[model samples]
Target: MTRILLIGAPIAVAVSVWFGGDGEPQRPKDDPSLRISRTAAAPDPLKAGTPEQQRELEERIDALPPGLADPAKKEIAARLVASAENSTLDWRSQYGVIEDIGDGNGYTAGIIGFCSGTNDMLQLVEHFTERHPGNPLARYLPALREVDGSDSHEGLGAPFEAAWAKAAQDPAFREAQDLMRDRIYFDPAVRLAKMDGLSTLGQFIYYDAMVLHGPGLGPQGFYGIREAAMAAADTAAEGGDEKAFLGAFLDAGRHVISRQKTEQTRDSSRIDTAQRVFLRQGNMDLQTPLEWRVYGETFRIDS
Candidate 1:
């Protein structure tokens, strides 16, 4: 399989030109000269992406043939998620990563590259333990917490590594991974899109960002992306336009995806550019018979 290497490594401040390309200080949104201001009412977080209501996109994704990703929602999302994490999609049957890939300290493993330095890895283990008590890794929760977000695998020695491999074989563990992904990425993106009047396509865009930058606020996480979009236009909750707000959000994501030169990310422009294609085509529902390219390779799904 061709490796996309499409996730993570986002650079913040991809595009922050306020006044001009020249080195100029940006004025506050309320700067009298700029005349930029928030909407009359508060920006709504709970209410968003309402267009998906009429779209019925979940049905469309369900209709896709097997092994085709709608980007970030269904089983296909898990496959693509694996592809993004390990540069391959067929890794569900494989396990044990002892080498550090310059990400999350070292030894990133599993479908989503659970690493010692990443807090999500700890959460994955914890979730697995909760479902299957007395699991080998259950005891390591304390050490996992202690070392969360740190590159140090401290107390997590060979036992933890072996347990990680063992758990991957368990169907329960696989289910747990999916559960964690949904809680952290898929569900939030869908709900947020609903509140913001976006469609499944919008929901997927949010999910992609959440997958890389965490569902919560990292330097350029979902909250920051939403914040950037909010700065541009009022959200649906604020009684502002929906299309305009979504455009702002995608633009912000585009900047982050393009933070490095096109060559560095292997032309990560695939993501932002593909979404732009859908937006232009008015495929808000993300209906299938889809085709797109990543890493200069074309992929399609017709069902």
Candidate 2:
């Protein structure tokens, strides 16, 4: 959503197994902190796409109270988001770059699809460079900066493409991917939700929109939507009803989603519709077996 990541991929949702541990559904074996002998869930090699099982996996994590009692357990939210955003639950799947997609960047990259024009992409490149100084992608910093707002492939050539390919193969680069998302979407949304007395669903709604519209006060940006929602109804943060605020917030989100020209696939529409349906059903906690449609493709996770 951040940039035009959904250029032209397969339309049908793949529904793979969702990631866990840190904002993931299950801890990885490679993590040093966990002892290696428990009967935890095995890693599903093929899981992490637009699969029915992804929804089923998310429905199982009812760890938080209504208003996101714990942001640490962000697995379900991120997991469910995979189906809507990337059609893949693995956060790692979203780290590649695409050039010249008319998206203000010849090098838009990362999970939330940070575009070169947006400073977020600068931060992403900077962070990656800092962690892995000698990384192949480091040399292209200047070219990346130069091409920030232009779709022109100008100075970037095989080196740039190879660097991105190399970065994808490194473990440290993968860490940077999650860090960027946290800095841009997850962390801010959770923090704001806590401030606004919003539940996990509200947190998710904010996070999801931020990923799409970028996090500012422009006409269709995340802040603008929230501002519009605030005008329509008072948030619990302002000593008003939480449900009313959430409903208003949702309406605002749908407005933004409707206008995004890059949403060629309309997968984002389901993100809004699903929340609207849940809120309509008074499922403020965003309890599962959720159902909705994106571009006329209906999805029901009632089981």
Candidate 3:
């Protein structure tokens, strides 16, 4: 049986009430001055061209030296499109596209488009899943690679475990679980999306939970990417490479802190109220410390 941590309902309600106010709590607007402040930080490099242009671009990309066709580029393209479409379209239309594409093919296209930073493909996948409650392809592709007991990387495992746990608990997620358990998949872009989604939902609690769960799956889960990045940052810092350090820290911040904020904000009203009161009183006591911690932990960085 899964050991679910059941937070008390009354405490949860109290926290929500304390945070809620007259109108919805306004999130802090992104700082226009900071380049990375906005989620939509930049435009997609792979714009949808006329079919001719797209074909030409894909041919060029495919023809590149193997080393030149980095997966990150494709993933970024997909993300840019996803972010844009999320803003404009209703969910149902998105679902239709995914259904039309069918399994394997739609997912494969999405993976390529996303990795290439193609906005259209990314948006299609995001909207499709949002509209289709049980998107088997979306859910399974990430986990399918793991079944072989090979390619056991840490970053890959964390998302799989979280998804598995969530699917097991929720009946609606059963199809996702089934697909994941029995599919052949390969696409780093999809894996990244799954990780991003899990982080967004606050279900990737392994970071903190690992500290308590002993050095097993959760700790091992973040071990691959987190340790590699941290080591790289340390090496760069030692060599006085400020640029490398900054980039490394930014990546670390994304992996470690991004999910925590999403978890706390699951009940936005309470978090907002707590933040306001804590700021006004300028006190950091137990009653109000969580809010302050969230703010500092999320936004502020020590140089």
Q: lDDT (CA) for every model shown?
A: 0.55, 0.58, 0.26
The TM-scores, one per candidate, come to: 0.65, 0.69, 0.20
lDDT of 3 by residue, 1-303 (tens): 010111110100000000012222112133222111112121121231244533433343233332201344322222322222222112222222211111111121111111101122223324445656575335644433232222223233345444433433444343332232112111222221122221111111222221111111121222233333435543221232433433353344344333442352122221233223333453312121222223223321121
> Per-residue error at 65 for model 2, in Å?
7.5
Worst lDDT 10-window in candidate 2: 8-17
Candidate 1 local lDDT, 101-168, one digit each (tens) = 54434446665555666566777787788778977679888997787666676888788888877777
**lDDT-better candidate, 2 vs 3:** 2
When sorted by TM-score, best at the front, the candidate numbers are 2, 1, 3
Among all candidates shown, the one with the greatest lDDT: 2
Clashes (backbone N, CA, C under 3 Å), per candidate, total: 11, 20, 15
Supply the global lDDT for candidate 2: 0.58
